[model samples]
Target: MSKRSDQITLVAGGAGFIGSHLCRALLDRGETVLCLDNLQTARPSNLRLLERDERFEFIEADIVNPLPLDVLERTWSIGRVYNLACAASPPQYQANPEHTMLTNVVGTDHLLRLAERADARFLLTSTSEVYGDPEAHPQHEDYRGWVNCTGPRACYDEGKRAAEAMAFDFARMERTDVRVARIFNTYGPQMHPDDGRVVSNLICQALSGNDITIYGDGTQTRSFCYVSDMVEGLIALMESEQVQAEPINLGNPNEISVNELLTHILALTGSDADVVHRSLPVDDPRRRRPDISRAQRLLGWQPRVSLEEGLAATCAWFAGEIDGGRVPRPTAPDRVRASVA
Candidate 1:
């Protein structure tokens, strides 16, 4: 977990929604960063935030192929490898299921090997989706998920499960330092406009004055963590000497129904868009929430942002995307609601 000042921390998928924020946070902490991304589902605009930093370097490559280890070793010592690669959204991952699966399987293996060879700490950004329609509420780390291995969304869900397996096996063999953070629903600025996540979808649709799409009567529940909080929890996991190979849940414990989330978004965006119901996507989790007592006990980390405050910022971000900065940035105080539209 210790690194010299000259050592580099590589973030695969660094230009993505959450990845970009992680990269920026490292840079803000004066750490040198090597951001590797394939640009498949990531956008160039996200990189604009890091391009000017002299300590930052972006390598455009997919992890499914051989990593540019020759370039990496010749230039700098890799102190850390945070594997946030692969498309996260259902629409994006489902669009190229093979690539998604390979990104998690082969891609994670590639990064783990790189970390092992570099003698660096490796962290895998696993997902909460592993608990498919979980039988248990407030899922914990010991729960061996209820995933459908053959479902349409299995490309990401099961693939991440396999990645965690390989990571733990590597740790079990003493290959390298490993940490896994099973992240729940996270949203905020820098999220791709078309990522098709529930938060982004509703906010963008509302800002565009379109009908709000709700799936499954909007009764399914989820716990949303602010992107900033997620980035902090991730950094804590990656840097902690206390965490070894155990998977820690990183998310807000507060849970709400999908309709509840929509209500918050509608209030923030001030959009009167009619709600439309659609069939739920295959294998969509009926309930999702993480019991983060492990995180609290192990890493001393928990989400610090409230739902309304986080959604306000996200609405502002999507508002700019929908209409070219017409909507002003969110400035509501705690416990107050204001419309971004």
Candidate 2:
């Protein structure tokens, strides 16, 4: 292990799906981790698994406000910071657009300053949504996205775009070492039961004999990367010395249409659910896929988990959640709390 591996790391959204997994991976590498989350879209149950680990610490706070740097400094010495704090799903993010915008901008700025104070490497988990309704297929790093700044999804899409701009500005002017990952759609275990993402929605609805709703004619396509694979790509990008101050696409290249994904989930769950169509939301991307050539060349990373294999694992986890009555219904927002293990 390198000497830097012993340094403390901070994860802004450590209690969320991807953030929790990254925290565990960092802990496994013998690094002390400080996880900060407000639990707005995430639940405390996600951090339950790491509660017993002495090296892991959880702080309940929102990133939209300035981070508790004083408390953090008293706790441990910061070395690397991973800013994954934001409402990812459309339904959740759209619920409070103002908060979402502030989190991506103000929250990101705070973390960048913290990174500068510690002289640590900073990584921003930007999203493919930055490339709104991409005019170019298989989006590469160089393609400037065609995004609507005033659309319903702009709070997140444009917010992330601004976050990327802020990160690069800090990198160029302040010379703060930074990494930006333009992550594509991802799914796996620990996803919120009511995350409102297509994968979770279809799987949960199929498992419970509900109609599989397909928005936008079920023809729109997305490339889904497994959570574990996505985490590996993030870590690789952060650790690589060759990649710096640039955005890299990290996702599986295999594109699947909404209808095709629904069929696969139905087969996997053995459900005879009916398929229902609905109007597509405003500014929804027609085709979503990532061009991971940069990730492959720079970080030696590409998704290794096949969709079929990854979906099966995800469905199994959702099944356990449903059978145990842990799945939250759409109408009730209070039931989204995490179940402590």
lDDT of 1 at 168: 96
- Candidate RMSDs in order: 6.1, 3.1
Structural similarity to truth (TM-score) of each candidate: 0.93, 0.94
Weakest 10 consecutive residues of candidate 1 by summed lDDT: 332-341
| 285: Cα error in model 1, Å | 0.5
> On residues 1-341, what C-alpha lDDT tens digit does candidate 1 reach at each position?
58788889999989888899999999998999999998877767789869999999998889999898643563338898999998888877877788889999999999998898888999999999888779998999989889889889999999999999999999999998999999999999887666668887778777877677888899999999999999999999998988867999999889999999988988998999898888898888999999999999988988899999999998887777656763333221121221110
Report how far residue 146 has shifted in candidate 1, in Å. 0.8
Candidate 2: TM-score? 0.94
Please give the CA lDDT of all the candidate structures. Answer: 0.86, 0.86
